[model samples]
Target: MTNLKIALIGNPNVGKTSLFNALTGMNQRVGNYPGITVERKVGNFSLNNQTQATIIDLPGVYSINPTSTDEEVALQVFFDQTNKDYPDVVVVVAEAENLKRNLLLFLQIRDLGFPTLLCINMADQMQKKGISIDIPALEKKLNTKIVLTSTRQQEGIDQLKSEILALVNAPTTSPFDIKTINPEYFSAIEKNFPTIPPFKVWMALTQNFFSTEIPLDKIEHFRQNHSIDVKKIQHKEVVKRYQFINEVLKKTYTLDTTKETDVRMKLDRIFTHKIFGYVQFIIILGVIFGAVFELAKFPMDFIEGSFEDLSNWVLDTFPKGKLTDLIANGVLMGLSGVLMFVPQISILFLLIAILEDSGYMSRMVFLMDKIMRPFGLNGKSVIPLVSGTACAIPAIMAARNIENPKERFITMLITPFTTCSARIPIYIIIISVIIPQTYIAGFIPLQALVMVGMYAVGFVVAMLAGKLLSKLLKYKQESYFIIEMPTYKVPIFKNVLLTVYEKVLSYITNAGKIILALSIILWFLGSHGGENYNNAEEIVTQSEAAQTMDKEELEFAIAKYESENSYIGKIGQAIQPIFAPLGYDWKTSIGILTSFAARETFVGTLSTLYNLGDDFEEQETQIIERMKNEKRPDGTPVFGLATGLSLLMFYAFAMQCTSTIAITKKELNSWKWTAYQMFGMTIFAYIMALLVYQLVK
Candidate 1:
């Protein structure tokens, strides 16, 4: 069978992802483009059971002229024919209603001399919007096959696949002449680089970074000899292409303005209102937070209880030994700490997916832009900030969407302040233990309100940090905020499910590895120790306190004594003084140290440490119960309100995740800035936590 490669390219919010999902279904895998953090999504399908086709969903771009890394990646795939992702055919997905605006990108791709097909998406909305296209005429004029697809209705998918197959064997052609923009200048360049396509040469000259067979010094020499005005040439090209697009669209497309309704405009008015927009957003956030805590309760309980039982079963069924102890007390206990919070994480991602699918997220961006601009950010920064709620690794990667270096840098540095799902496990456990389970106004759960407040604190701190960074890192390059408002539609369930599944799975897989390793190590440290640990039984038995204790109480006393002198305990004791100001004991100090690896590991570390001495047959061990009963040497409760709040504030601001730190380095491309971000945020978190504990205590 012949193998064919296809690339899907389009402007943002043009139903491109929806069409990709429809075409590929569950046959897709997401990865990063080599040597870059830009996400690459590839899927496989058989065409007519004869040709095997691999389709790449390229990052969205407005035009061949790139402004951001995302657009640059899209251009590079085409610019370098030797690129692994270079396609045999390109499918330019366009919106049915917004064909005029979408055609600019289509024409640019068409002129690249690829065997391109125009996939007009969202055809189901044509009649509702009173829009109609002459597909045959448009295809003839553009010199390509056109397929009208409605992903929601599953329309034209078979036809699209067939067209893609046919196009693979079709001859490539450039719809517009490059010489049309500047006959004299382009003609000279075409002569100089006769082997290269004139359009590719032009792109290579205009782009800041381009991959090509041509030597860089030669291109620089050519630029120096010709003294070319790149911006002028780019402007002329856009004007020429739009001139051609306007003529083609005017004759082949028609819209009945009278038949269209003002529902969208009215909704936009309400959603974008200055006063009510924020009000609605707050209400939506409340509902999401409420659902996260309330709906996840039953499943969280089930997971926690299930893990408890599994641990007990492992202890009871397996022969008593080190391996059995490791499985029961280390791995299972550690995993349960993070896994029990999956339901809440899943719900958060699900709601975020829905908001994005319905296009309400765009309005939030627009609403927040005014507030953001005064700080170092614009509306585009809102995406990375909002995405940070899921995970900072991808959230930092999402900053690539911002064209300006300054804003993008600030966004990356500050995004970790937003409470990610990793922090959720820590926050939920802490909040539940400290806050009362009561509601305000007889309906709103106070716990949920506190959760929302934690989110608010993170966001507010992020904004302030952005402002300070903007002042510190001076850049004069002005950036405009431009975003397309997609037509609102009922979110596709498949897309939402896929998004939630991918995000939650990513969280588990990434956090699982770190937690597993740390859990076993922690268990070892807590299980065995130096001479002190071995002598713990004798030490406790001979104590005056042991004289009045019964057998059960005496065993408990020995276990406690052993834990205080264990290997992990010695390490924690050495560092306890550093965290003592914040009311942290040796165990809490150990959790804080492990948290630097990943915030979620703090809970798992604590779980593994506390469960090491569990008598599973006599009683079930839960991390929360163990923590609640913990006391300091002086008999004061360890997890008092002051300490709980302090921990929350620390995680809220700290740069804890190693993955996030690595991605930040990659995105910023400077260890200087990365160090500044890491140490600065951690120091700030420490001070804030210290202040909170002192004031509240």
Candidate 2:
């Protein structure tokens, strides 16, 4: 089979991603370009039986002229000057209605020396918008194969594949004559190094590519030794390129000036209206949170029940010992806790995908940008801040697009303050335990209100932090914010499902690994103790109170005594006093400590701790039930409203995820900030938790 790499590159919102999705389907993987935070998407497809190729969806940019790190990566890879991720054939997707504007980028890639295909995407909408393109004239003028494709219409893909497969190395026509534009500039490059590709030399001189394919020191030297005014040369080049592009597009494209704006604009007016926008956004968010619980109820129940049954079966099937306990209360319990959240998470991912693919997400950025400006962040920070709701690690990574270092720093610092999905498991379980299930208007769930409140708590905290940080942290750099609102279209089902599948699977798999290992270790710690645990059976049976108890009652009492004396109990007792002010006993304290590995592990820890050795039966138990039944030494219910509310507040504000902290350290490249975030957030969490508990108690 022939192996090749095809890069899908174009301006943002040009349907490049849609085309890539059309070709690659579910065969794509998203990672990062080496040593950069920019997302990299690569996938596999076969043009023919023997013509298998990998397609990379490079970050979309307006031009090869680099400003942001994202654009730099695109240019570096296009010049075949990257360590890896160089494309064999560059497929530049352009909107048929806006070819003139899109051609600027296509022309840059064409000159940088690569076999290229120009795809006029959204062709189906062209005629309706009174747009027309002379395809043959364009192909001839640009000296490339131009394929008309409507990824939405599923048109022209097969022809595109045939063209790609039949292509051979071809020289670029009208490749910019650098000498004509600036003889001194060309002469300086040739004089220093004649062997290098002219464009590479031209690009290297104009701006630092900072690519791994070339030595960094050599680029720096070329930069330092040269007497080039970079901005001046870049300006001259842009003028010269546009001079050529204007001549080409004059005859090849036409648009009707009287074209009517589509329904998208009509909808955008109301949705993006100043007065209605925020109100509508909030209403949608309310529906989403409420629907998450409502839609996930059946699936969550099924998953919960299945795992519970499995745990019970494992206990009965295996020989009763530590191994059996480990598999039942540890592994099975942990896996169940992680997987149970899949239903809610899947809903969240699916809904988010719909909103993003439908192009409404950009409007959200537009709306929030106004609100974020006062908080020291620009509109661009909105993406990362919004993404924080999914998971903080990726959200922090998303902040790389914020061009201003100060703004990016502020974004990264406050992003974790947003409530993430990991907190949902924590929130929902607690809400179930403390909040009544009564409805307000016969349909709205009271528990769902608590869920929304939890999210609101995070958002408000993040906004306040942003406002404060904007005042405290000082850095000087011009921040840039520009976003394209793509023409709205029906979201592709396969793509939406693919996104949800990848995100949900990633969440469950990562959380499961940590929880499973912790559960086993915790079970071991909870099962064994010093002399107190060993003598529990004899001591409890010999007690004068046990003489009046029936056999079953006596057995349960002995089991309770053994559990309390276990090593895990001793550890919890050691830390119990510290959390006593927050209404947390030692057992709850242990749950908090275990959750440092991950917030979702809190529920799993409680499950493992409360799992029955004596009450092993076919019937299953819920975490809420076990927690509800828990008691203090004074025989008061352990998880009352005061304790549940305090715990909720703590998790809401605390930086509990070690994974998030480690990622923050790696992304920010500083352990000091990570340390500050961890300790600062935790201290705040403890104080608030204490306050809530004290007032409520």
Candidate 3:
């Protein structure tokens, strides 16, 4: 019974997450709040091994006034005591080096009358920046307990835990006067709802104009009767809060400007510059793609080789049967498809986490806001677009922060156009075959440049599509962009590595399950067949060409013939003509068709098809090498330059992932809009593939 739920809240980049990772370690799971797309992370840790506690890491927000739905969720918990997540105590995390800016949200939380403990994170950076805070004076002035902790150095953690455990009840009185923030509105609301807290009443009214929750019908009616100026009251409340925060800071906080000039400012000058910022961003992307290609190849090859050996061992150990084929060809092949690319995915996530934790990623938003505005997007859109490169599902979910429906919808529509992790495997498989592995300047790999070029193609197409959609879906809402530029520091290796591990694990576990199931189903379909398939041996042996072949070659021909007559091959052949103009044969057509459910299924499908009767192996051939050896009846490679490029173009444009479509439907709440996005991209993909194949051939 000795249990409590604590909510940790703060502005972004305040090392709040670092502290959470430190406190919870591996005891965390991510989920969503009920009836909302906003992500919620809950973790549990025992205090002193006596009292158990649940800590919810709420989404980061700048203030209580909710512009986006994520911020609304944050404020909703504080405003509505009836809500399930009303915390027992709040831990408001602030940046010690940037206490003044961090204090705004803290003050807002304190006003809500929750038992709040102020955690000044990044205390290790305070002395380096020559910033000093009178912790005792600040606690006394703000009427709260303060803990100066450093997640980096593991400082003040015990002190923070002891303080958090000891705290029991929230203070009865508000930190600042609620009536002082606009007497007319407060007095009016308080007069009617005398029993309810005035601060809660005010919040319910202000957010009611935006939120769908109907906590107080009286407050909604009362606000309508009074004809409240929502924006005007919001502005007045911010001004009043800052006035109080400034007075408190003047007494307890000081910064010496004489220290070494902030290197962050120097970096910002170029990093946020209009022209230079974009140039640097492109350079950084090229480096990331280059690292993904050249650096990950070693581990990727090892993984592929190891799996191939395992598959061969499974066949060698077990008598050939239906179960053995399913285990070796279906299950192991699916697992390999999932895991072989972990090195590349982990590398990309690691580099991205470093940029994000180091605070350089914010500059990207600033630089992009300029170009994004004309396309009906702002700095916030930069997040979903960039995250889309990793996966479109979460990226679309992240787009909830856009506030503008038109812009958010457009961002959602084009987000899938970005080359997701699924596409990375497909790209690697094809590019390694067609693009020569020559080094550029003997440093950068030529294949890496091609990878980056593919990403560039996706981004450019997404942006152009964004511009086109913006024009078609014009709206009158004005958008305001305000993002804080956190002080840059060396990225914490622990945090970065943890992020990479979690994300890469998620990719394998979540995507792997689907791949495994599909792989088995594909194997079954490829292995079993009707009269023609059953008669494949009879059909092949009767041919004069079969008599001249060697034993291994004859067996290979029989297996291929049987597979072509099997259920899956017949299905693929049915759609062959549709993709024939795009240079894809029946086998390639099967991969493309199966991939419509999930792009990662592309590799699994091919692996299952090519893995038939693959027991007699001496040197383990890679999936790419197998693909390279594939030929047409006329004695030409199937995956030649024109065909590979065409396939690449098709996948790059195609809206193949059904997970994205489901999320799009959920977010947009309209089948009409989702259909426009789904079928529209598919049509475009087909046309582009057709053009490229025809022109090149």
| True lDDT of residue 445, candidate 3 | 98
lDDT of 3 by residue, 1-697 (tens): 4888888999877888898888888798765666554656678888877788888888888877766655666667775567667788999999977687788888777766678899999998887788899989998888889999999899998898888887666464556777787787788867887766676666766665232333456766786798877778788887898888889989899888786467878888979887888899878876876676688778977987888799989999999888988888888976776676677667767887888888887788778888789877876687678767766765675576565556777898899988887798789888988888899898999999999999999999999999898888856644567666888888999889877776665555554566566567766887788998989999888889998988876776787787678887788899899988988888889889778767866776676567534321331246678888899899888888899999889899999975576567666756788889989999999999889889888
Q: Which segments of model 2 are wrong by more than 4 Å?
A: 35-37, 70-75, 79-82, 178-181, 210-221, 259-261, 378-456, 467-478, 508-512, 550-559, 580-591, 594-649, 656-679, 690-697
How does model 2 score by TM-score? 0.82
TM-score versus the correct structure, for each prediction? 0.84, 0.82, 0.82
List, residue by residue over 40-124, the lDDT tens digit for candidate 2.
7789989888879888888878888765655676567766544467778788889976677788788777766677788889898
Error of 1 at 574 (Å): 0.7
Q: Could you tell which candidate, 1 or 2, scores higher by lDDT? A: 1
Judging by lDDT against the true structure, name the best candidate: 1
Worst 10 residues of 2 by lDDT: 612-621
Compose the digit string of candidate 1's lDDT tens values, residues 145-245: 99999999999999999999889767667767778999998998888888777777777777744546677887887788787787788888889988988
- Once fitted onto the true fold, the runs of candidate 3 whose alpha carbons sit more than 4 angstroms away are 35-37, 79-84, 209-215, 259-261, 273-276, 376-457, 471-480, 580-652, 655-679, 691-697
lDDT (0-100) at residue 617 of candidate 2?
Answer: 29
Model 2, residue 9: displacement in angstroms?
Answer: 1.3
lDDT of each: 0.81, 0.76, 0.78
Ranking by lDDT: 1, 3, 2
